[model samples]
Target: MFYRIHQFWQAIHPIITEDELAWVISLLPAPSLALFQGQPLPEQRHALDVAQDLWSSGIRDSHLLIAALLHDCGKTRYPLQLWERVAIVLLQKAPRKIWHTLSRSSLPLAASLQAAEAHPLWGAEMASHLGLDPRIVELIREHHTPHSQEGYLLYQADNRH
Candidate 1:
């Protein structure tokens, strides 16, 4: 895993400074760099790696990479926790119209279209507010939708060994 990370690190440089890089490196577990691949980086790093893969494939579209990186960032709230909270609020307080709106969306792992519909919007909204590029946010929003042809290609490239 470390070898892959080293390979990736050697290939793509971040937008951050040396000091920031050093700080990020210091925070990573020594073995984690070597042992964990792909899905193993800290949430942000995982996103970065995904973006790097997209870029390396000659996809110069930076927004797609940014979308790849932040796809699951909302998971920071913890999936179970957020779902439960959302459910409680919907059941107890939300208006019928709002509940109907929520019922149409997707869940991350569910096979339903609802799950697929939910991810891009949620991810894009959070990422854009965090100062991610507008285009990237668009990619994130469209990621799971049928409209995301280019972004999906980048995503597929990123996950392949």
Candidate 2:
């Protein structure tokens, strides 16, 4: 609980310095760069941190870096407020049927909840639209599942940051 609280606080005020933006731009293509910049400041910072962590650990796959930077781009469709994020985190532990029910209903946070649930697929679609590597799109889709070795690395790095 405390850890989540701390994470939420950090996310509420993500600080991305100019130097960090320059570093990020140097690593990404124009299309992918646009998507990365489209994300919330906190999410952008988080993605950059994840990519840097993977790089430091000797994972130099360009696709992985792209995946790390744009994995959460789908969240732009239905941006979650701080409370909505907290709700989604708690609701995620509930049964899938319950989650679906709430998400589909006309509840106040329903759209945000549904968006959170579907962001991975949405992100994958966006990646494809941008003509990103198929591997990068797959990573964005499967980051939460982590079945492959690369997926495992990304998942670990995402959790760490």
- The lDDT leader among the candidates is 2
Task: Tell me which residue pairs clash in candidate 1.
Answer: 2-34, 47-69, 105-114, 106-114, 106-115, 107-115
What is candidate 1's lDDT per residue for 1-161, written digit by digit as tens?
A: 56555535633443444664454344333432221122223444555556557656786654454456556554433333334434532343557565456556464423222333364576666666666557666766665453668767755754442
Model-by-model lDDT, in order? 0.50, 0.86
Error of 2 at 7 (Å): 1.8
Candidate 2 weakest lDDT stretch, 10 residues: 1-10
Q: Write the per-residue lDDT of candidate 2 for residues 117-156, one digit (tens) a residue.
A: 7898899999999998899999999887876888888888
Off by over 4 Å in 2: 94-98
lDDT of 2 at 81: 83
> Candidate 1, overall lDDT?
0.50
Error of 1 at 40 (Å): 9.0
